[model samples]
Target: MDQEASYGFAPTEFEERVARAQRLMGQHRLDGLLLTSMDNIRYFIGVDSTFWESYTRPWFVLIPATGAPLAIIPEIGRAIIEKTWVKEIRSWPSPRPEDEGTSLVVEAISGLPRRHGRVGAELG
Candidate 1:
């Protein structure tokens, strides 16, 4: 799809949401948040893609305690994500079941500055 047209929330709105989440994370002593679901990802980064309905691959966005989120996604979705405000993105070729960006995810998580060494993820 053409990402030429901007989509989703204003950049400031997304920034405010991240700030609120970070404040909450500080109260809970969390170092970061790793989100995988489409809803949560959209809520934070404004990526709304019907392609996500396929479920053939995974998508991730890592929101550290005090900065912009990093989108870890499949290469196919890069164009869509680029239209959003997020500036840092990492992608890998999709459908490689043997790897499927697991290593990249690990690397992204490991690179965070963690005082609590605790990362929150969507569960249940």
Candidate 2:
């Protein structure tokens, strides 16, 4: 590994984890997976940036029922999150419980036309 690549994750690792998750989704009849935890998102998207600063901030990932993962990050963290090959991205600002980035997620799901799909969330 080169010095610049020392802290970064690889794309192959990302793809493998996503394939595994998709398989799990199929097995569980889950529409998709929501990742609010750091490691889980990294495993799926290969973004290994610092995330401890996000507790007061809203941070999560929405893996759509039909496409790649989309990250819901703070406005300031968008640039770093975008470095991942996972192109889908949405941002939310702090000091607002409204979570505007949520709408982007909603639109994606609404466009799915999956009227009766089960949303298996791991938020508990």
Candidate 3:
């Protein structure tokens, strides 16, 4: 591979993953999937970041049942995520624990065509 090639999974790989996830969501009657962890976020968007190590910051990738994945992340990650196949990116100022993107996330979820009124999430 040439040095110019980007890192992480290929664009097509991410597309397929999102497609499969959407299919599963359809079967499960979920309106969307809210991915918060680094692994799950990276899996869909192919964005790897060391900043995820900071316990203070949280990143998200919301995969809707009918469209491309939307990345709700800190503004610092905008540059990195822009390099990926994800087109819809929403970012908030970092270290704002008072809000910490909670509103943005809720707004994104609220706009989805929620037939089942369900959104899948990765919970420990």
Candidate 4:
């Protein structure tokens, strides 16, 4: 079975969702979106995993204004994230209190077109 088939959503569906989100972002004059919640990540990238139950590592996904979504996650979830629609996957060793995925998140955000840009985050 193919990855998408197993995930229960076609790649096109994921692309459509990204397009819709980008359209909304543009309309709102938002530069990008930073998603930290597991549900939000799954909705954008089709990454379904129970590993999120472990709080040792944090996962994030960044959707730029005009390009593909980026996944900044732990090395443990690399394989699963790879199977998702997202192509840019940045990973690091988890449970590292010193850094964790903070550097990667910064790097991803810095790549956005605008400096000191308005990024929407899921707060709830």
- Candidate 2 clash pair list: none
Clashing pairs in 3: none
Give per-model CA RMSD: 2.5, 3.0, 1.8, 1.6
Measured against the true structure, the TM-scores of the candidates, in listed sequence, are 0.92, 0.76, 0.92, 0.92
> Which ten contiguous residues of candidate 2 have the minimum total lDDT?
1-10
User: By summed lDDT, which 10 consecutive residues of candidate 3 come out lowest?
Assistant: 2-11
Residue runs of model 4 more than 4 Å from their true location after superposition: none
The CA lDDT at 8 in model 4 is: 48
Better of 1 and 2 by TM-score: 1
Please give the lDDT score for candidate 1: 0.87
Give candidate 4's total backbone clashes.
0
Per-residue lDDT tens digits for candidate 3, residues 11-67, read: 678888999999999999999999999888877777788977787778888999998
Better of 2 and 3 by lDDT: 3
Q: What does candidate 1's lDDT look like per residue over 1-124, in tens digits?
A: 4442375877678889899999999999998999999999999988799767767788889999878889998899999888888899899988888876789889998999979989999997
Q: Which residue runs does candidate 1 get wrong by more than 4 Å?
A: 1-5
